[model samples]
Target: MSTIQKDSAITLHFTIKLNDGSVADSTHNMGKPAKLIIGDGSLSDNFEQCLIGLTSGENKSIELKAQDAFGMPNPDNVHYMDRAKFVGDAEVEVGTVMAFSGPDGAEIPGIITDIAGDSVTVDFNHPLAGQDVTFDVEILSVE
Candidate 1:
């Protein structure tokens, strides 16, 4: 069996859970594992550290902090825009997630936090940011 190492693409089953133990995501639930290349920045450095020496068919659980996982919510990502900016038949309501073209021409998502008269407050932070998360991993195969 090949051992998981840096830059190796390994197939594994993983579950992301909150501190409360409720699962946020899991491949075992789908009955299939996911494949990812090691050291590709797809997994956090902390998450990768836990798999460094694991071989095929190994199972382990790893915990990561906010900074090591999805990272802290950045205040700068939050912005307030004119409610009119969201024109058309769609109602500009609070808690609605909308995507708009950013300066880089890519679509950026922002959630409406408040709907003030002629103004809408939006936050673009990741939903999981600023929170610690845990990963329960089951190595299915390594190559």
Candidate 2:
């Protein structure tokens, strides 16, 4: 049985739940295990640390603070864009999420929070930011 190490590629079923016990994300429901290499920056450092020595068929449940999980929300991530930006095919209703092009041409998801006569409030913070979370992981394999 191989233990997770610095560069270990592992497959695991995981679920992230908020402090209120509401699931934020889960791989088990999709019937597909997630595969990732440790220390690859795909997962947060605190999250990777929780799997440092686990072997195949092992399971762990860890609780993480808001900062450790998704970091606190930054006010600067909230922006008010001109309502004209959504005139075309973009939806303008509140609670709608749209992806805007970033500086490097990457898609940045922003959720519409409010819509006034000429302005639309968009929040770019990750939905789970500022909330403590619990991670339930079942290690299936380590390579």
* Best candidate, lDDT: 2
Give each model's whole-structure lDDT: 0.87, 0.93
Worst lDDT 10-window in candidate 2: 83-92
Judge candidate 1 at residue 16 and give its lDDT: 90
Overall local distance difference test of candidate 2: 0.93
Native-referenced Cα lDDT, model 1: 0.87
Q: How close to the true structure is residue 109 of candidate 1, measured as C-alpha lDDT?
A: 85
- Candidate 1: clashing pairs of residues: none
Model 1 over residues 1-143: C-alpha lDDT tens digits? 79889998999999999998899888988988899999998988887888999998888888899898888999998898987677787678887888878899999988888877888888998777888898888888887
